[model samples]
Target: MFNSLISYLDSIRERDPAPRSRWEILLYPGVWALFFHRIAHWLFGGRLFFLARLVNHMSRWITAIDIHPGATIGRNFFLDHGFTVIGETAHIGDNVTIYQCVTLGGTNPTNGVAGKRHPTLEDNVIIGSGAQIIGPITVGERARVGANAVVTDDVPEGATMIGLKARSTLVPAETWLREFIPYGTPCDEPCEPNSGDRAESLERQIAELRAEVEALKAERRGDQPHKMSGTNC
Candidate 1:
C-alpha cells in the first residue's frame, strides 16, 4: 500500500506540468482524494456505512470533490484537476481518465433509494473537461467523450463522442490522439485542423468553381455566334 501511494505520487508529479514546487505537488487535492477514496471504499465494502459516509463527507469538504462510497472505482483512476462529482451508483473501471467538472450523475427523477441510478464507465475511457455523462448508461471501454459533451446514452467501445446531443465522431485510438488531442507544450505536434469545417469550406470553393466555369462557358458560346457571323462574311 505504501509502495502504491509512492507510485501514485510519482505519477501525479510526472503528469502535472504546472506544479510550482515540490510542496505544491505534494499538496494536490487529487492525491488526497485518491487516498480518501480508497479508505472510504474499503469501509463501504466492509459494511461500515457510517464511517464510510463520514470519510466521504470529509473528503468532499477538503477536495470539493464528491465521490459516493457505494461507487466502484478501479486501479490507476486519475482525476485531473479534481473537483469532479460522481454519483452513488456509478461504476468506474480501470485506467479511466476524468477531467475537471465532469459529472457521472443519475437521471432518475425520484432520487429515491439508490440502485443503479448512475452510469457505468468501462476501462480506459477518457472523459474530457466539463463533460456530463448522466443516467444508467454504460460508456464502453476505450471510448473518448469530448469536452462539454452531454451524453445520455450508451457509448460504444473505441467510439469518440462530441457535441450537445453527443454524436459519434469515431476515430481509431492512434488517429484520435494524432488528429484531435489539444495542443500542449509537452505534445510533439499540433492537432490536425477540424475536418468538419474544412469540408464545408471545400464545398463552398467547389460551388464557386462551378459557377465560374459556367460563366466562362456562356461567354465562349456568346462569342462563338459573333465569330461565326464574321467568318460567314
Candidate 2:
C-alpha cells in the first residue's frame, strides 16, 4: 500500500514537466481523488455499496473528477486538469494518462444489459483532452486518442486516433511518443516534413511498414518481391 502511494506520486511528478516541489503533489486534487477512490473501492468490494457510493460522492464534491467506485484504475495513472468521468465497470491499465474533460463512459445507458458497459484501456494508453471513449470497446496498449476525438470503436495497439470525423486517421502512437509533444495539443510527429500533416506522414509510414513486413515474409519463403502500394511508394 505504501509502495503504491509512493509510485503514484512519482508518476505524477515524472510525467508532468513542471518544477513544483514534491510536497505540492500531496495537495493535488487527483491524488486526493485517487486516495478516496481506493478507500471507496475497498468498501465496494466488501459489499458496503452505500458507504462506497457515499465516499465516491464526497470525492466528486471535493475534486471535480467523477470516477465511479466500481472502476478499476491501475498504477501510475495520471489525470491532468480533472473533470474526467470514468464510469462504472471501466478498467484502466497501468501507465494510462488522461487529460481534462475526458470521459470513459457507457454507451448503453438504457439497454438493461448485465455485462460490462464501459471501455477498457490497456497499458500505456494516452487520452488527450476532451476525448470521449464510449461503450465496451477495448483501447489497445500504447494507443492514443487525440484531443476531442469521439471513439466508439475499438482502437488498435499503438494507433493514434485523430481528426474530427471528416478525416480520422490511425497511426502508430509509439511513433510520436518518441518525441516530446506539448500537453493539450493534438498528438502529431514534429519530425515529418511532408505537407505538415502528421497523420499523412504516419499513414505513409504505416504503408511502408506493411511493405517491409511483406518483403521479409517473401524473403523467408523465397518468393518474388511483392509490389508495394501507396502514393509515396
Q: Return the top candidate by TM-score.
A: 2
lDDT of 2 by residue, 1-233 (tens): 87877777888899898738777888877788888998999999999999999999999999899989999999888887778899989999999999999988775433355578789999999999999887788999999999998787789999999865323334456644434321322322243344458777889999999999999997967643333334336
Tens digit per residue, CA lDDT, model 1, 3-115? 87666666556656777655675677766787798899999999999999999999999998899888899877778877799887899998788889898877543434546
Worst 10 residues of 2 by lDDT: 180-189
lDDT of each: 0.79, 0.81
Decoy 2 TM-score against native = 0.68
For model 2 the local lDDT of residue 31 reads 81
- Scanning candidate 1 in windows of ten residues, the lowest lDDT window is 180-189
How far is each candidate from the true structure, as Cα RMSD in Å?
A: 12.6, 15.4
Off by over 4 Å in 2: 109-111, 165-233
